[model samples]
Target: MKNKFQAILLSYFLLLFSGSACDTPEPGPPDAGLYHNYAELTQELARLQAQFPELAKVVSLGKTVESRDIWAIKISDNVTANEDESEILFVGGHHAREWIAVDVPLLLARNLLENYASDARTKNYIDNGEIWIIPLLNPDGHQYSVTTNRLWRKNRRNNGDGTFGVDLNRNYGYQWGGPGSSGSTFSETYRGTAPFSELETQLIRDFAIEHQVAAMISYHNYSQLVLFPWGFTNAPAPDQTLLSQLATTMADSIFAVHRVRYTPEQSSDLYLASGDATDWLYGETRVPAFTIELRPRSSSPGFILPDRDIQPTFQENLPAALFLIQWSQQGGTMTLRLK
Candidate 1:
């Protein structure tokens, strides 16, 4: 498995990242596949663990405001122990409406496990590296999106008034209360009363730090961008060159799969979103963090990325992830210093 993984690293590395422009996507309605609801996601994680006990391990980081378990699916060779293997963390569903974001990581987890034996590359990564997939980070918000509101963006944290949530992305400790972050309870981008005030954000923060994740990608949708940090500010990150290169490589890999173009950018390029997960992960853990805003950049409706797009989205992002895993194993993954 390791030999094949290395073989892929040498052979497909160039094709995946530095390939020629792919043709435009075919015109059609993206398949509205069965997007998983909160309950379904929990069950799916459990099923993966049950089926692949050696490679898959399910554990709850903590519970959300609504008391839903924030599950972590750890896929690695030594599932029970945290060995020397370099870890790459993938988190999705920060916003409930970005249903495609949720499925991407879930699909990634499923593919890695189901193909462990049959696929040599998958087997190599699973057997040698630690891949942590947290498919639904904001479960309460996801549930809210499904039942009450289709566009809920925050966790179900009831503010003192009538408002019901704080944007988890905007509530991280780094750059808290800065521009692009909100203080009003009713605001969709609310930064919360204080940083890491919500259990969900705090849980992720603590877990990522404890595990010392080498690289982290927080998934979102409707932008078709691969964003690197300094999300809180316009200043370049210390590891700008490497970060930019990796992000562009991933963007190129995604483009090659679906012929969909995704600009590799700094978060502030689109807008100022302070206290976001990417920035916090980098500042707090020195993990080379990225936020991949998935598919249908201009034409598709913002958050309502169709169900059919889920498979292709994952297909495109997987190669970049594989590249990152291999790079981390070689100890060149995260170069930025912790703040």
Candidate 2:
């Protein structure tokens, strides 16, 4: 398994990042197939762990209500060392319909690992800071989106009143049952029976506490927006200046590439989302956090995005993410431009 993993990783590395002196595989015809599914994702995670045993470790954070593993991968140059480092957590697939969300984090994992030695910035970040990527947070929901429905947005947990799932976004412990939360299980924004009632959210809470994470960015799709903390209410987090600066810098870097309009605002600006991940992370741990809503706003609808958009989306986001790491290392704030 380990040998196979090394081979797979090496092949992807050669094809995606480096094209010099590496063995190029045969030009097989592209299959009219869909992107990777939950099983395939788990397999990819295992393979990554096997290939980069020293730098990567696949941890079972917790299980979903359906008993699916909420897997997490920790990528750093030195995992055994107890020394503290600026850690950045990147999560994806919080909303089940966003298929591209899964790929972005996985792409980030490969990009950082494949270019660690060659790319100076990536190398510095990995060596000086830990990058944790939870490629798929809602495994059951993601799987359901691929198999049964294309619009599933919440986790697969029966709320005991005929409604199926709870919006994991509104299930966090911070400001539970607050505004933007609906008691109606029929609604898409159902807040679950109680905060942290779902094991999936609990797993994230545990991971945050155990790691003492410094910063985090969760990936979502179709909004073309970058959102900061204080989602539960309009009030900003204590480190509002720092958060704003980082958010602005990230937004600027992204705009330079695609020249797209991405507004960085608090969650309340979009809509009051109580007990959201961004609010929970910042409100609880005081770790700077942001939710990055990625690509194709009006041009595309639903989860189906073309294969051609994948590389470009990854490229645009890469710079912004790296800037955050650089900002953290310098102990600088996220910048914002006043109109």
Best by TM-score: 1
lDDT of each: 0.85, 0.80
Across residues 1-339, which tens digit of lDDT does each residue of candidate 2 receive? 999999999999878866455463333332214456888888888888888777787888877877788888888887656558866788888888787888888888888887876888888888887788998999888877777666789998887776688888889998989999887899888888898888878877878777777778888887777889888788877787878878888889989988876778776888888988888887777778899888876645535677677777788898888887777766542332111
Cα-based TM-score, every candidate = 0.88, 0.84
- Ten residues in sequence with the least summed lDDT for candidate 1: 24-33
Per-residue lDDT tens digits for candidate 1, residues 190-269, read 99999999888888888887777889888998889999998988999888888899899989988898788989998889
Prediction-by-prediction clash tally: 5, 4
Backbone-clash count (model 1):
5
Q: Residue 6 CA error for candidate 2 (Å)?
A: 60
In the order shown, what is each candidate's alpha-carbon RMSD? Answer: 16.8, 13.4
